[model samples]
Target: MPTLRRTLGLLAIPALALATALPATATAATAAHADTASSRTVLPDAAAAGWLARQLVDGDHFESVFNGTAYPDQGLTIDAVLAFAASRSSDEAAAKATAWLAKPEILSGYLGDGTTEAYAGATAKLLLAVEVRGANPASFGGVDLPSRLRSLQTTEGRFSDRSQWGDYSNAFGQSLALIALHRTPGDAPTAAVDFLANSQCADGGFPLSFGQPTCAGDPDATALAVQALAATGRTAKANTGLDWLAAHQNADGGFAAAGATTSNANTTGLATQALLSGGRFGTGLKGWSRLVKFQQGCSADPAVRGAVAYDATGFNAASGTRATAQAVLGLAGTPLSTLSAAGARPDSPTLACPAPATR
Candidate 1:
C-alpha cells in the first residue's frame, strides 16, 4: 500500500510540469515567441523512448554494446528501466527491456558478480529500479532491497561504503538511499536528510563527496540531490542548490559536467529535472532545448532515431548509453524518483526503519 501510494504520487509531478511548460499559443504564436517563451523542445516522447528501446541487447538486456566501452549490465539496465517509465513507453520493445532487468541474475549483478559481497550503491540503485517498476524489492533477485539499503547507512548519517569503488559512490549513494527509503513507510532519517543537505558546498551545489575539503558543486550530483529533496517534500531546503544550478547553465541550451563545465547532455538532462523542481525551467529553457538538439533523428539513421548525445560534438556509443537514459528522464520532465515503486511491504509487522544514531 505504501509503495502503491508512492507510485501514484510520482506519476503526477512531470505531467504537471509539462503542462506548465507548454506555450499558451499556437504554432505561429510559438514561433514568434520563441525569443522569450519557456517551453520544452519539440522532441517527441516516443522518439526518446524509442532510442533507448533500440539499445537493449538480445530481448532482455541493454549494454553499451555500441560505444566500445563495456559498462556493467547492471547500471545500464537500471537506466533503461527509468527511460521506459518516464516516457511511459508501453510498446512491446519497452516491455522486453524492462522485463530483462527484473531477472534474478541481473538484479544479483547489481550487488556485484554474485561471487563477491554486494556494493551498497549498486544495490540501492537496483532497489530504486524495482520500487519504481512496482516489483517486490524484498524478494527481488532473491534478496531484500530495503533492508540492505538500511544496513548501508552508517552512524554518522552517511550511506558510507568502502566497496571496491572506494567511497566514490558516496554522494550518489547517499542521495539514492534517501530516495529509495523515502518510498517506503517512514520519514527518511532526518540525519540522512541533513547529511545530504550539509554536503552542499558554499556554491549551493553538492560535490560527489559529502565531506570533501575543496568540493565544488557538480551538475550530476547536485541535480540528483535536487530530485531527492524535491520528491521528498524538502524543496524549500533545496532551493539554493537549485538556484546555483540555474545560474550555471551555459549560454548554449545545455549544462556542463563537473570539472569540465562544458555543455553536455547528461548533465543537462539531470539538471533539467532540478530546474523543473525549482519552477525555473523558463530560466533554463536554452539548456533544455540544447538537449533536444542532442537527439539523433531518423535523418541520421532510422536505427538510432531517438538516441541522445553526450555533447554537441556528437554521439558516441560508449557514453550515449548512460547519457541517453538520463537525458530521457529530464526531457520527459520527471525526476529520479519517478521510477520508484514498492520494494517491500512496509506495512508488514516486521518491517522497521533502522534507528538513527543518537547525536
Candidate 2:
C-alpha cells in the first residue's frame, strides 16, 4: 500500500468566509428545490455497512470492466474510474493501469492530439497509478510524462487550446492536469497550484470554464479541484473548496452535481471523497451517512441502492458492491471496522464475486 503523506502550506482562510460567500442559494434554485429530506434518510445500520463493504469488493470488477472497455476511449469516464480504482486499491487494476501507461495509443490520443477531456482523465489516472501501484513513473518507454504534461500549459498557467478545440478553460480538465503535475516531480506541481489558486471564483467555488457564461462555481468542478489541490499540498485551497461543498449539501444530506436536481451516487461519492481528502470529516460523515441510507437495500431507485441494469450514467451503480466500495472509501477512509473483526484486511476482500455483474 502507498503511504499517505501530508504536506504543510500557508493559505489559511476561515471556513465561515467560504460558507457566507458560497451560499446554498448560489447553487441553482431548481436543483436545490428538487431534493427532499424525506427521500434521503439514514439507512438501517446493517444495510449501510453491508452496502459499503459490497461496493469495496465490487470495485475490483468495475476496474476490470473499465480496463476492458472504457479505457480504450481515454475520456473523463476512464479518469473517474481510475480515481475510484486507486482509492479502493484494486489488485489487478494496477496491471491494467500499467498497460495504459505503456500504451502510446492511449497517451497520444489524449496528450498528442490535445483532447482536453482525455488528457485530464488520463493524466489523473497515471498519477494515481504511480502512487498506488508503486509503478516507475519513468519506466514506460522512457516517456517523459511530466514533459507531456507541461505541453498542456497555457499562458495563464492553465492549459490552452489545440487544433480549434476552443478555449481550454474547464476546471475538470485543469484539476486532472493539476493532479498529474502534483504527482510528477519538480516545478510543475507548483505551477499547477498557482494556476488553480488564482482561478478560484469570488464565491470560493471554481467555474468549469474561464470567463464563460455558465461559469458559476459548481460543486462537481469544485470537488475535483479540491481533491487535486489537496493532493498537491495546498490544504487551504482544498478546504475552501470543501467549504463550498459542505454548504451545497442538500437538506437530505446528498450533493448535487453543479446545482443539478438529480443526486446520483457517483457525484455524491466524488464530493464525499474530496471533502474527506480535505480533512473535513464532519461534513464528509454526514454526506456519507446519507448516501449509505440510500443504499439500504435493492430498490428501483438508483440513488437509494445499486442498479440492476447497466447504463453509462449508472455504471457506478451496477451493484451494491460498487456503491459500497465508493462510499466506504469516501466515508470510512480505511478498512471497515466490521472487516477487521472478521479477520479481513483493508483493500483486500474475502467475498466471492457477485453474479450478473450488477450495473
Residues 293-338, model 2: lDDT tens digits: 4433222343434221111133344454444444444443321110
Q: Which regions of candidate 1 are displaced past 4 Å? A: 1-43, 64-72, 90-95, 113-116, 162-165, 339-359
Q: Per-residue lDDT of 1-359 in model 1, one digit per residue for the tens?
A: 23322332244235334445666664532332232112222233335665666666775566544457755476777777766666655345544655666676666656754333557678777777777777677877567778777776778777755466565557777788888888877646778887888788887888876666797888888888887777677776578888888888888758888878678888888787667645675754555567666766433444554677788677787788788788876666666665532232111011111244698
TM-score of each: 0.77, 0.62
Error of 1 at 217 (Å): 0.8
Task: State, as a TM-score between 0 and 1, how close model 1 is to the true structure.
Answer: 0.77
Q: What overall lDDT, based on C-alpha atoms, would model 1 receive against the true structure?
A: 0.65
